[model samples]
Target: MASVRFNLRLVAQSHWRSVHRWQPKRWLWGRARCCMSSLVGRRVMLTRPASQAQGMAANLAALQAVPILLPVIEIAPLADTSELDNALFALAAYDWLILTSVNGVGAVWDRLAELKVPGLPPALKVAAIGPKTAHGLEQRGIQPDFVPSEYVAEAIYPGLGNVNGKQILLARADIARPALLRLIEQGGGRAVDIAAYRTLPAQADPTGLAELRRGVDVIAFTSPSTVHNFVRLCNGEQLRFPDLPGKPVFAVIGPITAQALADYGVKPDLVAVEYTAEGLVAALLNYFESQPLRNSL
Candidate 1:
């Protein structure tokens, strides 16, 4: 993961190389009409869940890119959040509270609001993995004490620093990975993990599938599940991301998302430095900026 920083420029260039090898402009859209912005007239495929997709869509539109809504995942509340409620009810027992995603922050905060929990426990500090997560916590009037420099699990435990014997509460998605929990425990901290949300594959509409087949300029993936469901939606039981027409380029949010595509034998054309919404958009524009002719917008 550390080496990723040094290889980013190489990866960005490598993606351009791949794009150049393809029938020129098939992916870049030859001779696009400029709209006084870098992304004017570009077709950007947004593959995040619908609720999350709106924000990204507006961002793209701001840059004059036409956003194509192609949601491949859905977020739902857990059938039962009793466990989470119980943990929140006893916040005093914990020394720290951990949140891994914006969704988790939202879920836990929403529940606390329902229970009318106070701002936050004074002694129980909080940690969030990403900026969005921390920002979500802030929106609820609870400031997170720490947020990992990097978004992945590998960065969390270390970021917490000297958590020996500390009680930590980890509120996350129902299908959240256990790696973070194990790491905290290994560091001599007692961690309690609760599920605040569930991410399920959303049914893809046939119209959306048909548009995908017709090809768009770029397909943006924000998470691993989006990549998986994208393949499932396009390939069905055959279970493979189709050889999408129109020479679409894959722009991922970060390394985790890039890795997800790699698992399915797909190489992302570009990966963001920061694992946040702003970072994703900036990275995509940077990719286009690398090519002078493509920069005319």
Candidate 2:
């Protein structure tokens, strides 16, 4: 009996080490630590670009949640950067440059760096929709003159203060909404919008369906493109949303993404009030922490 108890203890220790390999702080002083933010057994789906999904997955893992990578869309460089080139070469013409996404910042800066473009004209000011966008510009040694309190274009366009007779350069994805340009023109500003990158649905296998067939807790959509591409893939694969096991909660980044989901006649379970990565994660945590779940799929 004594030897059997000792063997069981050894088995428990080995199992604990294996389970906590990625989570080293699970035990302290022979007591199991409880983290308020842990999502330990939850598997959440992420529908962002493939290249951008890893960072989010790392973040999820930090919260003790499993990140299900479901990259529905990807950003591609525009074949014709001629228009973008013209805008870059004539940078002095624009009074304000607005960058809405990190992809835009990368594409624009890549070309500008290739030409060894000098400092932006003192007369020109730069605007980024959010911190992430600003960080992208900062990496290229440029700082935004302004970032709106809210990350949406609705807030950005109106917050520009006075734009009477000012020329604005809006560099963004090929399929970006034109409302910002319309807003600029409505504010008495002439705008030159250029496509720095093109967004297209990525060709990927619809993985994790078998897991979903069992159940999933949440599916998060980060963009309108992601919403569209995901639904498209589901339809093509004959994977109906209603068939998703457990009636998993659908989390969307912001109002725009939520509206996209609504277009497909599906309502989101949660919409982030703040549109950034941190905001989405917080929303997810808020949801599961307040709700109970079954022990397993």
Candidate 3:
């Protein structure tokens, strides 16, 4: 049975090689390695707002995936900024300014410039829900006092210290969830939730829609709003997802976005370990590399 044992050893070696063709360490390489990637030539559909898709698109492109920009949501400034203005005018009265997204930071700063507000109050603490949001604040020479390890709304409360008897200004999207507001209120803080920007359903780009109709390999959702807007746009346009051949893989940036997909009787094939564009791309690479092993088994 020595020959039989030798044959099994060879078979195992071959399987191992196939499974680990692409190593996670190689993903750190700055240059494109598309020639050796399973994601090479794969068409990835981006469903975030057009303004936000560029970075993610560039990441995918660097990895040699064809990024089809099918922005399902648009971020627009509120038509009536009266309340936003009122909040900004009295910024010194608030104890904390909570920003959840890059879009929120942009909206707030744009209004701040309009109001000729030089900067935030010296005593006013700032909190960001994620590193990306924190980076946005940093770009404007403002450093956040609190940034949660977990990038979700629920995670922000714990890092916010004692909010008891404090006034917190939450600048967020028009359709933002009430979880953060509820959390602050439960902790005895008065939270003013303002619509910093409007997340509206975008008219799908014709070129991108055409590319999608031809068939894409994967679709990525960054937020719940993207998922919701994607469904709304698809249904409103009479495009039946069930009819699409060889259903594309659904990928989400986080659990919340995945949950949004699940609400519509859909499940994500990949969820990013980190809720960021780079994390999503890394997850996709890891996923595609394991396909051979999955198929072999």
User: In order, what lDDT does every prediction score?
Assistant: 0.74, 0.76, 0.80
- Provide the lDDT at 106 for model 2: 90
lDDT of 2 by residue, 9-51 (tens): 3354344335522232232211213454646667888878767
Off by over 4 Å in 2: 1-34, 206-214
lDDT for position 62 in model 2: 75
Model 3: worst 10 consecutive residues (lDDT sum): 1-10
Candidate 1 lDDT over residue span 174-288, tens digit each = 7777888888888898988888899889887666666676667789998888888888787773433646766677899888889889998888999987676667776777787
Q: Whose TM-score is higher: candidate 1's or candidate 3's?
A: 3
lDDT score, candidate 1, position 51: 79
TM-score of every model versus the real structure: 0.81, 0.85, 0.86
* Candidate 3 lDDT, 54-162, residue by residue in tens: 9778878877778989998888889999999999999999998999998999999999999999878777878877666876886887767677656788888987789
Worst 10 residues of 1 by lDDT: 23-32
Candidate with top lDDT is: 3
Best by TM-score: 3
User: What lDDT is reached at residue 260 by model 3?
Assistant: 90
